[model samples]
Target: MSDSLAEHVHYLGLANRSDLYRSAISDCIAPDDTVADLGCGVGVLGIFCLEVGASHVWGIDSSDAIYLAQETVRKAGLDKHYTCIASSTFRAELAEPVDALICDHIGYFGIDYGIIDMVRDAAKRMLKPGGAIMPDKLVLQIAGVSSDACHEKAAAWSDDIVPKVFHWIDEQARNTKYPHEFAPGELCSAPVELGQITLNADTPEYFSFEAEIEITSSGRFDGLAGWFKSHLGNDVWMTNSPLDPNGIKRSQAFFPIARPFDVQRGDRISVTIRARPEGNFLAWDITPRGGPTQKQSNWATTILAEADRATLDGPLRLNDNAQASQYILSLVDGQRTAAQIEETVMRDRPDLMPSQQGTRNLVRDILKRCAVS
Candidate 1:
């Protein structure tokens, strides 16, 4: 198995998240029912369903780790009730309709990692009529946060310790999105519901929402914090909200501002969010009431400056290897094997790739990038 997949399997083997999912699965599943476990890493969820008296479980994942999941089921003596498929739910064909579908595709703040599209597609195609999905409803909440700790971590690069390197790091921090942990006392305003997402056949692939939050405490506002609450069946649910006593332990979404602003009680902050299910891109705009608004988008951050563009558009300089990289990428057709590609690269550009071993490593790296499965 690949290192990345192994890391994921190790993470899923941890007790905290697995315990929560096991409890929810036991509550939602029924005897003599077929279950579809989407993105089933190591087949834990499907095995949990089988232990709860599920008739059969289909464990599907896109990674090669499905082989490990099959082995896990066999070792547990549950292979007769579980089938592991090493294919994405988008391309895999189900032999029979499932009575319920369960997936933990949620990311930080509950929108990233393309969960919405995956759940929507499975609900429409793989589930039987009236079939239920775990965490059927999701509500995203946003609040204005006053966190000196977070501000220090995000703006540390602005210090004059290392001028050139820190300046670039400061720019990157301002232009990037991050997952953060917020102390309850750091919240300057009560969380407001930003949006609600329902997983079903009628849900749209694109959505936009706006909300106004009233600040209840006086403090410095550096950015916004986002978390989600999910409604699993039988009144079992999980949330990461700061106010919830029984919420899951997970990071909240943090969108850093270019600069911090001081504010007083009764101040109002307006926020707008746009989400695209296709690429799981979320754009946010936050404005202090009567102040200038700032916009940040996960889809279009790190823009190139005009000066940099002009430099690239100028005459080709010596020792520039961008063309060689492009040529290597161009040869990544579906028909050519990695060995053939390595031989062609060695024969064509011996100066770029000197040794056979180096060419083989280069070909392997390029093929990994170009691989779709």
Candidate 2:
């Protein structure tokens, strides 16, 4: 194994294995049962299970930790019953279904190793119907707040320059890769670091989860960190935070301001995260420090025509209210031309008229995108 995998395996050395031990003891494994250890790391948890009387253990990992696990198995004189494979959970290549599956290869936000999805798929293909899984589910939670410091930090890091020098530089670097991953959208304004994440779990089911969070910063909130919860079974819950409690630190997905607005302190920023067959999405809000007076997307109402939507594709993150999306939607009847739709929409929604020419131009752009091949 190379040094990189070795280092990755060594990370298990830092894990607080007390949770694994407790879960193993409480779950009640038989003397001759089989276990498949996913993301086995140095195989400490699997080795620990053998110490506690498990009959057979198979350890799998993507890192160099498999070598360490094999060494540990050999030293313990359990070579017959304990084995190690240096591979990912998605391709463990094991021949037999096991009685239990053990995995702790999760990051702060929980899906970093792609192990959760792997395990979910594995349970469907590899495990027997009566088998148990340890550390099953994880959950995420969030709160909102206002802060000058957070705003300043975003401004400092954002690409909002007045004279346009930085914008040109940004354009040059559009195709270049960064040391870290950047979001799909351009940075319209500054952003704030929402919070950190922590891990907590161990139970039945392939996976199971919950999160409790305290929000510190608040603003006219635009986006948020993705938090998640997994349920191992009805019994165990795990939490994944963008504000990671472990040393693993990386950026969270950016949540753009659905509508531009002002936010204040003490506002409750509440969010819930769940999984779907497709992918993950989040809905969030910040209560005005005051009462409900104006909706957040009022700027959109002014700029968007009934037949238009914004071109949110690039740095500007334009709104669809501009007659883009709706115009295309309207064109489906094939009876009305783009110009006709613009005229009708203008008549119905006068608020969209910054000017007549602008409306015509917006409609023209939409029709251009909707032009059939």
Which candidate's lDDT is highest? Answer: 1
- Per-model TM-score, in order, reads 0.80, 0.50
* Model 1 lDDT per residue over 150-226, tens place: 78766877866758654766756765667787888888898999999887647676888899999989989988888
RMSD of each candidate? 5.1, 17.7
Q: With candidate 1 superimposed using the best TM-score fit, by how many Å does residue 346's alpha carbon deviate from the native? A: 8.3
Q: How does each model score on lDDT?
A: 0.80, 0.50
The lowest-lDDT stretch of 10 consecutive residues in candidate 2 is 172-181
The stretch of ten residues in a row with the least summed lDDT in candidate 1 is 316-325
Error of 1 at 305 (Å): 12
Where model 1 places Cα greater than 4 Å from the true spot, the runs are 1-16, 165-169, 302-354, 362-373
Candidate 2, residues 163-260, lDDT tens digits: the string is 55544432222211112213322222232323322222222222222233333343354433343444443454444333335322333333233333
By TM-score, who's the top model here? 1
Q: Please, what's the RMSD in Å of model 2? A: 17.7
